[model samples]
Structures are given as structure tokens and as C-alpha cells.
Target: MNREIMTFDNVGLAYRRSLNPFSEKNWVLKDISFQLYRGEVLGVIGRNGAGKSTLLRLLAGIIAPNQGSISKERGIRSQLLTLNLGFIHKLSGFDNAIMSLVTQGKTIKEAHELVAGVIDFSGIGHLMDHSVSTYSAGERARLGFAIAMQATPDILLLDEMLGVGDKEFKVKSGKALKERVQSDQTAVLVSHSPTTIRKFCERVLWIEEGAVKALGPADTVLDEYEETAPTRGNSPSKTTTATAA
Candidate 1:
């Protein structure tokens, strides 16, 4: 049996409606419960505004649940990878890579050592010295992804940031991501891409209207989800495949 890495028990999150003292609270997630097993690529599928990103935030400890609890193995590190990571607009891509690594608890020298791999993986070595403000969206996303991968967190919370860059880069990045997923990395992948979910995830959790509608084997849950929204499953985009270990 796989070891349990993290568990969410009836977790809930809410945001204030407004600054008004009498304003009502808006619940974003409610009664979410799940257990994450080590070395599993758990997919999270949801429609827009379904609180998918919010769920990743909850997993990353970026926010706390308003109710219930989340438990994790001691000293586990989780890194949330979004298209827009905290890159300083004025800083160079090289500098941003180091900064991101250092912020992930790596020593300065260690960050420097790992940054070479990040640069190579990103395929943005030529632009390493260029200020992030000058990078195109795809460029920025690639750099962020590279840094996140090199950081090597115990849990990687990915928020729809996969399949970055052009066709060639997509293929390369997908291969690298596949290697990680097939390894002992526990990841929670949130995506609207059915192809991505089907290809990479062993099991899936479907969220609808900010609640878990279903959680089960990838084929079963995705079959049900696609039945509800046929076009979503058929949505066209670049896709890659991997065996879920």
C-alpha cells in the first residue's frame, strides 16, 4: 500500500464578502476530504471558477481552511507551480531562478548549482540575463516551470501551468514532467484538459461548484465528467502521454 503523504479532512475555506463588518462570508470550498498517497499523480479536474486553484493554494499552505483540518507528513515541502510565479519584473531570468530556488529553502550556493539545470530545461539560456519584464508569456511560463522542477519539492501543486511553450518545448517539458510523475513525487495536478488528465493521472478528483463531485480511478471519473460536458473532453490542444506509476 502507498504511504499517506497528506490528508484533508472535511476542509473548508471562505472569504469575506467585503470589508463591511456585517458582510456575509462567501464559501469557496466545503467539506473537501481526500488522502494523498506518496508517489501518486493525483489529478484535479474542474470547470472555471470551481475553486480548483484555491484547492492547490490550500494544499500548498498558502491559505488555511476556515473549518476542519489538513495534515501532512513532517517536514514535507510543497511547491505550487502557476504560470505566474513570483518573478520580479526587474530581475533577470537567471536571478529569478536563483531567487525561487533559495526561497524554496535551498542555500545560495545550492540554488546556484541547481540553476544551471533550470536554465537548460527551460531552453531560455540565451535570455537568462534579460529582465523578466521583457519576456513573453510563454518564456516566463517556461522559466517558472523549470525552476519549480529543479526545486524538487516533495509535493508539487500544479495549477494549469503544464504544456508550456511551443511544440518542441511542450514535448521536452512533457517528457521531463513525466519522469517526475513516474518517480516518487506526489503531485496534485489541476487542469481543464481531459487529455492531460487521462494521460498522466492514475486517479482523479472532480470538483464542481467548489465541491468534490467525484473521486475515483481516472477512466471512471473522467468518463462521467466528459459525459456531462462533451465538448470539454474533446477540447483541442497539444497533448502528451505517460504511464502513471
Candidate 2:
């Protein structure tokens, strides 16, 4: 029987601003509801400050929703949300890979094997022996992605991490992502790149003010989103009209 991999029921998130101790609730997200099934890729898009990253974080169970609920069935794993999420500047890439695997419940020997494959996949070869701080941004992203791939997650959540790499690496990684989706793995990718969304995801969700504005087939929704997005040099009208009471 097919099972739902993840579900969000009216999920909401709010946080107190550090500078505004006396302020009331400040909601970053509200009334989110969705279900994800295995073998499906869901693309999420939103304007800046629309809470795209926060939504992904909720799905990954990294933070609790301020209201409502998020549930996940067994056997779900997630990659780092961004390039710098799990990397420690002081740690070598090799050590980071080993630690990532170990923390995910692999034995030391198993971790070694996994890290070897990940290092090869990253194409970093001997660079793995150097501290992550010494690596370029693209290299660090590749290392993080490699470590996550070693985990063999059932559900993968990516948040614009692909933007860090060069064109060649982007092509390679895009192909890898396609294979993952084709192989019955559930994935949620948050990106501003419409091309990436259309290429990998079968469905798309357009989020605004933390609510889903559109959810449907990828091409249809993405087209709608593109048409509605604000373009440069366009601004809201400014007029002054007042009525005396």
C-alpha cells in the first residue's frame, strides 16, 4: 500500500523579533497544508521574505511550527538546507563526511566506505583532506550534497543549494536529481529558477505570505508564477485622496 511520506496540516510559524521585545506575534508562515507521496517531486517558489526556506525547515522537522501540525512517516532523511548548514570551518572535508555518516547511524567502517564514494562523486579527490574552510563555495556545496546522497534518504528537501556550483557541476547534479525522482524517491526543491523546477518536478507550488497561492502541474503553475512576479522598474501606484469625516 502506498503511504504518505509527509503532511502539513494548517502549519504556521511565528517568532519574536530580537529587537522588539514588546511586539506581538510576528508570523512567518500560516495555514499551510499539503501531502507528499513517494516518487513525486514538488517544486516550491516564492518571492523574498515569502517564507520559502521556513516552509522547507518545517518539512524537515528542524523547527516546530508555531501553530498546527507537521507529520512525517518513518524513513525520511534530509540534506542540509544551504551550503553552510552542517559544515564546520575547522573540520576537514573528509572528517565532515565521516561525521555526517556516523551521526546518521552508520558504523565507522561503513562511514569510511560511504565517505570514499562521496569524495569520488564530489570530484574533490585529494582536496577532501583539507579543512572545509579552505574550499571554495562550490566545492563545499558539492561535499555537502555528496554526504547527503550517501544517506540514501527516502525524502529529500533541497533549498537552492544547486546555485552554488559551476555550470558543469550543475549539469551533473541536475542529472543526479532527475534519477532520484525517477526512482520513486520523494523530493521537495525550493528554487527561484523556473527552468530547474520545470525540469525536475512534476508539480509546483507557488507560495505567497506563507500560503499556497497555486498548486498544480509544473508547467502550468510556473507559468502563472512567472506572469505574476514583479519585474524591475514596476512599482505600485502612489496617489493621495482624502475624504473628510
Candidate 3:
């Protein structure tokens, strides 16, 4: 039996400069290869503009690779979850949940049945009755997240998308994902939170400048990243790492 849930084979993704076609393509990710195993939470760590989000989109099959291919077992359901976007803004939160779950292959009846659980976890309270457009940014994020939790895909692609509600919700959401991974559901998580990765991930992959920098045990990968990564405070981003050398 193949234990791998997804295999990325020398994958590369690039986008052409719209203004200058003859110019070199802006490569977002390059020569990426990895095997995601069943029931594993593979944490991805990288600095800003490191193509972490691009990698998640590739894994979710939302975009095609410019080179090579990503192979997965036939019929495995995969979905991307991100707090930055989701839900129909004009629709009520309840309507958005129903639409999302139905689009994920659930029947209307089935989706309606799952509404209670979504509401309970979303913690949006009575605000769910209003149009999502009327919600605060954080409220929108919470609603989107609640709808996503109704379906448990075979492969969950998380792009730095931990819950954006109150501190308590963030804690509970993190624990919920850990539970899902423990139950033999696979996931790829991209997060800046080293503590979250340290607590939940079995392994880690670090990407830098569109390429793999490291991939291994969580502690080892995270340790190497922190040691080499440039300071993130008042200093310029690339200044510390390169100038110090």
C-alpha cells in the first residue's frame, strides 16, 4: 500500500511579467519535490515572499505547475483553507456555509444539518444572520473559517490561515487541527508560528527564494531557519543575513 497521500515531482511554477513578455519569468517556486504521508502534519516555514502560499495553491490543485507534475492518489479530496479570503460577502453567514459545504459535494440537506456545529465553532453568535459584507474583517474571517470546518478533506492545505478571532478561538482552532491530523487526516500547514508547528507538526519544510532550504524533523528544520533567518524588526529584511556574513 502506498503510504504517500501526495507526491510533488520536481514541480516548478512561474508567472510571466505582464509588462514585459520577453523578460525572464518571475519564478514563484522551483524544483519542489516532496511526499506528504497519511496522517502527517507537515509544517512549512519561510520568510515573506518565499512562495509558501504558491506552494499551498500547487498542492491544492488550484493552479497548474509550469514544470513537472503533482501526483496524488485518485479521488482524494483536497481543499485549501486561508483566513485571508472566502465566503460570499453579500450573503448571510449561514447562507455562505450552506453554499460552501454544498459546493464541497454535500447535499443541501446535509449542509443544513452541519450548520449547528459550524455556528458553535465559529462563535460569531447572532451576527451570523447579517450579510457577511456588514461584518468586520475579523468577523468575516471567523465566518469563513466556520464554514470550512464542516468538511474534512483527505488533504487539508493551510496557508498561514490559523483562526483570526479572539485568543481563545485561535487556541481551540489549533487544537482542532491537531486532532484532525491525529485521526489519520493529512495536512500541509504554512505558519509563522514556530510554537504551533513545534506543538503539532511531525516534520517541517523550509522554502526560501523559490526553493527548498531544508526539510526534516520539526525541531531541526525550525532551529536552522531561526538561526539563519534575517531579523524581522526595525532592520531591513535582507540586510542582516547577508551583511552579517
Alpha-carbon TM-score of each model against the true structure: 0.91, 0.88, 0.89
Model 2 alpha-carbon drift over 4 Å, by segment: 19-22, 231-245
Ordered from best to worst lDDT, the candidate numbers read 1, 3, 2
Residue-wise C-alpha lDDT for candidate 3, range 36-102, written one tens digit per residue? 8888888998878888998988888889999988998898887788765667889888888888888
| Model 3, C-alpha of 245: deviation from truth (Å) | 29
Model 2 pairs in collision: none
Instruction: Give the Cα error of residue 199 in candidate 1, in Å.
Output: 0.9
TM-score of 1: 0.91
Candidates 1 and 3, the one with greater lDDT:
1
Model-by-model lDDT, in order? 0.85, 0.77, 0.78
Candidate order by TM-score, decreasing, is 1, 3, 2
* Every candidate's CA RMSD: 5.2, 6.6, 4.6
Model 1, poorest ten-residue lDDT window? 236-245
**Alpha-carbon runs more than 4 Å astray in model 3:** 19-21, 231-245
Number of the top-ranking candidate, with TM-score as the measure: 1
Q: Which 10 successive residues of model 2 have the least lDDT summed?
A: 236-245
- Cα displacement (Å) at residue 193, model 3: 1.4
lDDT of 3 at 169: 77
